[model samples]
Target: MSNVYIVEDDPVIAGAVADHLATWQMQSRCAKDFEHILEEVEEYQPDIILLDIKLPYYNGFYWCMEIRKTSKVPIIFISSADDNMNIVMAMNIGADDFISKPFDLQVLTAKIQAVLRRSYGTALSIHKLECGKVELNLDTTTASVDGSQMELTKNEFLILKTLMEHAGSVVSRETIMERLWGNDEFVDDNTLTVNMTRIRRKMEAAGVKDFIVTKRGLGYIVGE
Candidate 1:
């Protein structure tokens, strides 16, 4: 499922947005610890973020810029500050879209869907997977960890995507090779091993430790 993070501090508005998003089969979490919003976002690794202006610690613009340093995930600003200047500033600060408060839920949902499609291609059904602090963008074929992003080769991206999709499950090497070969890549055992090693090195260099764990004869997994 697509994950969305709601950074609105208002409990009522946040809860309402979360509920409406749930109806659309999107998983959402409202921010509770505003003090460490960025850390929470890194952990959540949302596909999209619904941010609000005039927040407690820092405004949406600040957080949006902060998130931009680490990720290119789509962010849509939702707030009562509907002035042209505010909207312009939000866009300038890396916001994908903006919506004024008291807006129709259907309209908001449609906007969210559009942004998701625009940012991550037309496949709104595919989810961006996260393992610990690392987030793999399936659409972009890229991986981000601790604010640093690395472009993954097609094979490498597929391998990480498969493992992150199965998270704790032991994805057999045969299963991964099948996926790569199905993409017309013609991957052999050695090629798969090479790709996995490269992925691990890139991830570790980006400050992701122990991201992919080898299960000896089994396969590989993101977590224990």
Candidate 2:
């Protein structure tokens, strides 16, 4: 679940794009306060951004320049201002890709996916996995629940990644061990238990309770 920050001002277009992105398992946040776009970008920490050129107070060029000052998050301009000058200017100021208005939703999604693959590297296109309020940043190996983030050990991240990838169902302990060590034959079963305990403790410390649930004979389930 890669988070997208859409900086379009048109309510209809923003809503349409947000809804469409949701179908691809991408989360999107539309900008509300145009005057403080950079602040919102920092707070959201989106994997990519969809920026529009003509805005209320300041235009997309100004916002793109401001974002370039601090972060390297990918920004794609989606605007009706699709003239050659606008496109060249957008690229010059660090826009990853530009899509004109009256575009196909599917094409827009494909472009976003391509930009993400390019920006984060092919291996990291799926930068985040989310379950309810819990979000795991695969690139950072950190988990955040309700905005409180915690550093995860390599084993902890692998375990959580496996479980959250199958969020609604139980993942068997044997399967989790296999994922962790690449083979269940040599790894100690108890190691998984210890890791689970630590994960739970970390979750509690971060204000999440029973985020991973034991199904007795079944393994464990998150967001169930």
Q: Please state every model's RMSD to the true fold in angstroms.
A: 14.4, 13.6
Tens digits of lDDT, candidate 1, 1-224: 78999999889999878876764557999998997889999999999999999899888888999999999999999999999999999999899999999889768888888898888786674547787888876545578887688998867877887788788899999888876674455555698888999998998788777888989999998866
Deviation in Å, model 2, residue 173 alpha carbon: 34
| Candidate 2 positional error at 177, Å | 38
C-alpha TM-score for every candidate: 0.56, 0.57
lDDT tens string, model 2, 1-224? 78999998889999988976764567999998999999999999999999999999999999999999999999999999899999999999999999999899868888888888888786546578899888997655689988888998878988998899999999999888876665448777889999999999999988889999999998999988
Off by over 4 Å in 1: 125-224
Clashing pairs in 1: 70-147
Q: Candidate 2, TM-score vs. the true structure?
A: 0.57
Error of 2 at 191 (Å): 50
Report residue 27 deviation for candidate 1 (angstroms).
0.4
Go through the candidates in order and give each one's C-alpha lDDT.
Answer: 0.85, 0.89
